[model samples]
Target: MKTFFSLLQKKLFAENAPLVMLVGLCPLLIASKTLISGLVMAAAISSVLIFSCVVISLVRKLIPDNVRLVAYMIIIATLVSVAEIMIRAYLPTHYVNLGIYIPIIASAGIVFAQADNVASKNGIVVSVIDGTLTAITFSIVIITVSFLRELLGSGTILSHRMIEEEYGMSFALSGGGGLVILGMLAAVVKKINSIKKSKKEGE
Candidate 1:
């Protein structure tokens, strides 16, 4: 329990997949145009990442180094397909809203990188823990981004009308705006990390 909490903190801050590592940015930006859409994307990605990591870890020994990347891609692609189908069959509303973006998880660099760096080298338990923490941290970041975007761009949150539509700035909801926000977020996190590093060094 202590270890899980510690790792969760690390993934959430020190090694955030989106804000820090910059993985899964495409979906993070597009699907996160709305809070609910971000939720859909985050859930789908969490499922795929967790499942792929476990499978890869379980069969790590059988995979050859020469073809490891190819094998990892196949595993991730297959898991993403499963997640997509599940989302489509049950969450038709989100499926309509998020359409093609859910399938993009298979191509996300973070998933493959985790599979190679953590899963392929670690046991199933460790891989599952890592995947779960990564997913949780990722979900938090995307939801935060989307909520801010929705509030700023649409002047509403989940259509709750935080402000009048007339008052809203369309730019906040656009791709360029998302990039600017993401870049800003990345810079803030980097600054915080640098300060912490300096403080530790000084100590």
Candidate 2:
């Protein structure tokens, strides 16, 4: 139990999927123009990842080792399809806004990484936890980026007008701008980790 909790903590913070591993940047860069869109994308990705992980873990033993990658892809595609249906039914606007990115989640490296490295090897409970934590990590990073971009690029937060004048930079709303911001964020995280490591060594 202690080990499980430790792993969860690491997944959430220390080994954060978006910031650390840098996976799933396609949706992160594109759908993160607004907080609402970013949240919706994150939710969709999370749902698919969690369900796919659970299903894959359950059937891991039955799948042949050689064909596991193909099997994982199929499982992820099915889950992504379900997620697409749910999103379309409940959030039509987001469904249209997200567009092709929703289906792209099926091939996202973050999802496949967890499916291959964690779900394929771990028990169902652990796999679920891993998926959930990974999703949360992805959400945190993307939402944070979206908040910054929307506030800076559009002078608004979640579509709410914050500034009286056009104080926001338009470039921040673009994909290239997102990559720059993400890179800066990664650098900051790396610096913070280094500081923590040094402090621990000094202690």
Candidate 3:
């Protein structure tokens, strides 16, 4: 249990998916205009990633070594399709907002890469943990950007209207999306460098 928690923390924070691995940037950038949207997309994508990884891991042995990539893609697509259906039935609003991006999760290179590189070779328990960690990492980065951008650009958080109604900017489609992503990327990189320097000093 201690080792599991340690691995989880490292994957979720020290080696975050979006900030460190830099995966799932498309929906991350697009849905970050509002904290609500970013959170919704993150949840959806994370669920898909976890499910896909589990399914792929289960079938890994059956897949021929040479055709493993194709097998993984098919499994990912199937899981993403199921995710879309479940989300549409239960979270209609999020389903609509996420739109085409939800399906794009199937095509996300991160999904296939994780399956092919880590999950396939690992046991079920480890694969599931890795998937959950990767998903959390992806969510943290995108949601952090969304939080900052929504607060700074529109003075709102999670669409709760933190700033005065008259004072806040409109939640238009393209508002601060690119700028927020760039700023977050820069900030994350700087933070990583600072951490490395601190580690070296400690050493």
TM-score of each: 0.95, 0.94, 0.83
lDDT per residue (tens digit) for residues 107-160 in model 2: 989899989999999999988988888888888888999999998899898778
Among all candidates shown, the one with the greatest TM-score: 1
Ranking by TM-score: 1, 2, 3
* lDDT, residue 76, candidate 1: 94
Pairs of residues clashing in candidate 1:
none
Model 3 Cα lDDT, one tens digit per residue, 42-148: 88778878887778778878888998778788888888888889889988997788789888888776787688778899988888888888887778777777787
lDDT of 1 by residue, 36-143 (tens): 898888888888889988899999999889999999999999998898899989999988888788888888887887898899999999899999998898898889
In the predicted model 3, the residue pairs found to clash are none
Error of 1 at 118 (Å): 0.7
lDDT for each of the candidates? 0.88, 0.88, 0.76
Q: Which wins on TM-score, candidate 2 or candidate 3?
A: 2
Poorest lDDT segment (10 consecutive residues) of candidate 3: 168-177
